[model samples]
Target: MATEATEIEITTIGRRTGEGHSHPVWFIREGKSTFLLPVGGRGSQWFRNLRNNPTIKLGATSAKAKLITDQAKVGQVMDEFSSKYGAADVQRYYPGVDVAVEVRDS
Candidate 1:
């Protein structure tokens, strides 16, 4: 069977409220790692929450997230997203966005 590598359910702890928050979002899986990007970039609520806390749930898996600030890595992830989901879709959903979330095995 093929791997399902498109979207994932991410559960994050709310920074202010201290409650669980879930969001279904597009993801990129490469080997043992996964990556995510906010459609609206760094100003997004989830991103803000993640900044406050890196621990998160990726589907049924517990993972630690690192915000990818390296310009080259961010560009590469963006390219991978464009290739997997198509440029038009990326443009439609994520315009002028460069930040990325790298979710590692925990």
Candidate 2:
């Protein structure tokens, strides 16, 4: 993964349609894991899709996703995002920080 890139395209299977859907999302990489924050938290369409199917694609890289709902863990992921994307920008763009997604290499 390219650490310098600010954003990456994530492809997920639609919960209802069972079809592929791709969207640009901001992410932060730490060691072997990648963290992502849904713009609308658990309510985001992508997040909901992941709940049904954890499989995903970060650009061309296939991966598995785990939803981080624990408050403490989500906070840590949020902090990482703030550190990388700037606090102001994160706060402005991500209003609902109730959940996070952790992506690991497959």
Candidate 1 regions exceeding 4 Å error are: none
- Can you give the TM-score per candidate against the true fold? 0.91, 0.96
- Per-residue lDDT tens digits for candidate 2, residues 1-92, read 78889999999999999999999999999888999999999999999999999999999988889999998998998899889999999999
User: How many angstroms is residue 36 displaced in model 2 relative to the true structure, after the best TM-score fit?
Assistant: 0.4
Model 1 steric clash total = 0
Candidate 2: residue 51 lDDT (0-100): 97
Q: List where candidate 2 sits over 4 angstroms from the true fold.
A: none
Best by lDDT: 2
TM-score attained by model 1: 0.91
Model 2: weakest 10-residue lDDT segment is: 97-106
lDDT of 1 at 60: 86
Candidate 1: tens digits of C-alpha lDDT, residues 44-75: 88988999998789888877889987879888
Query: Candidate 1 overall Cα lDDT vs. reference?
Result: 0.85
